[model samples]
Target: MIFSEEILKWYRENKRQLPWRDTRDPYKVWISEIILQQTRVAQGMPYYQRFVAQYPTVSDMARAREEEVLKLWQGLGYYSRARNMHATAKTVVSKLNGKFPETYEGLLKLKGIGDYTASAIASFCFDELQPVVDGNVYRLLSRYFGIDLAINSTAGIKQFKELAKKVMSTTNIRDYNQGIMEFGAIQCAPRKPYCLHCPLNKSCVALATNRIAELPVKLKKSKVKLKHFNYLVVVDANGQTILEQRKGKGIWQNLYQFPLLETKEEMAAISLGQLKDLGLGDHPSILLYNERPMVHKLSHQHLYTKFWILRTDKVVAKAIPWEKLPDFPVPVLIADFIKRFKF
Candidate 1:
């Protein structure tokens, strides 16, 4: 199709020189695709480089500790992706004999490998005829062809996948897939796209119908629930602070944070009296109090956090030397607090 040919031509002349695109290694491609799922290219590039350097092979990642893997992925949100990626690597080594699945269906069987990721790895690494249907592809196809179905809907996803397959090049699968994604990212961007000089402007239905902003319709996101976090930065006379690893299947799982006290609403004051109520101890002095709460927003949760420094003369249990705080992996909010307070 002309659409495919034009996009491929544009990609050849204008695509970014990404490290992942330089190799046909399925492992590297898989890593890049996973990192870039909810992350921008610029943001995910360094993480991709770090993963490639730390775990040069799937066996390397399989042998590494989950804590070490989570540490490397500290600032990157969506910790589950890292955990799943680690699990998938182990599966590749133990179950698949250190080799990634060669087919789209086989790749999808691995942990965290969805249709889009499977298609990307299969086409880019194995030159398989699988079309990737990510947000970029959805936007490109919807706008260019004037498809109005919600990209998040069940029917919309199926329709887009079928259309993507139809337009995808059978022989030049890699370039065609890359071209469509890149074109959507840089050319037909969501905001203020350069439509005047677009290669497919003449054939774009959205442009012709004066509905460039309306073509790629998406369902409204659900309301983000608000939560209050009261972090007890407990410190002893020897400059030791207590940090607990987050457990359970919630946000920031497996990451370190201060002893937390979650409340339905913001606490007016976390005083010495409150410490006794919380069963931590009695008569501890409030060393540092952040009157202003820091607002940390996640995809589905809005955390209103306040850090209270509780100082005591006696040694507190589970306390680590303050200087060694950087050794552990923490969520971005905690990491930023440490950086700002020079902890």
Candidate 2:
């Protein structure tokens, strides 16, 4: 109980005044939790504000189009999260009568709601006795208890979950969960934690053992594969540009982008002849070509992208006015090209 008491004490004095913490609204909590996954608070805060402003409620999000949701989540990178959140919103509205699931088990049934998110929503919104074990919790608990197990391993996950449940306050589970997560985020940080001033310094096993840097181990990530993309920005004399929706299960799914020609590697040589081979009609004029390819790195893939501006007399289907390009949702890579080219 002392561990919970100390963490709550520290939280009361040091917790950041985040927007999501101000309300017990399940919808807002769900949005904030999803946005903050694999994202830092400072970076995700604006997106949360924008999402809440645009879609004030779960029903509002459910009624909105996927294109509109993807447009708002343009730079957030994880396109699947946007798609899943949209699907879950619709489910909540259609099936649950717009009321978010009140229990951890019920929340886990929703799309994109994992154990951590479900536990967060259930406990924070409904005050359920569920402990959240996110990255922050893993770090704080692993270090404080000096557990050497790899946090990603099955044994470590089970052990940490049990420990988290044990330490969580029954009467104040919401603040206890928030306190420990916040404690890890600020005080017991991944790097250069404030051990000297920590309230639980005397009891912290890692601090006592001088192993603060080594307690929370993680498995090494798999190698990132490289992909080369050649995007053709096709435009006709009428200033209409063609955009296509990505149809497959891959990065940027359901988002709009320029005509893409993926090659085994960076094209050995790009020319009009190669353009014809890529299915573009013959005699397409190359107005501009970025000789220098831009590199965009994702978690598991590194993309080498080159954008070429092509002019063709032949009519192209799905062509929209160039001035109205912003009306559609495109990947950040394509968006950057548009901004740079002022298209």
Per-model TM against the reference: 0.96, 0.95
RMSD of 1: 1.6
lDDT of 1 by residue, 292-343 (tens): 7899998898999999877777777667897888888999899888888743
Model 2: residues with Cα > 4 Å off, grouped in runs: 271-281
Please give the CA lDDT of all the candidate structures: 0.89, 0.89
Q: Give the per-residue lDDT digits (tens) of candidate 2, residues 207-316.
A: 99999988799999899999999888887756688788999888899999887889987964568765634334777777546777799888899999888788877776
Error of 2 at 202 (Å): 0.8
In angstroms, the error of model 1 at 105 is 0.6
* lDDT accuracy of residue 143 in candidate 1: 93
Root-mean-square deviation of every model: 1.6, 1.8
In model 1, which runs have C-alpha deviations exceeding 4 angstroms?
A: 271-281
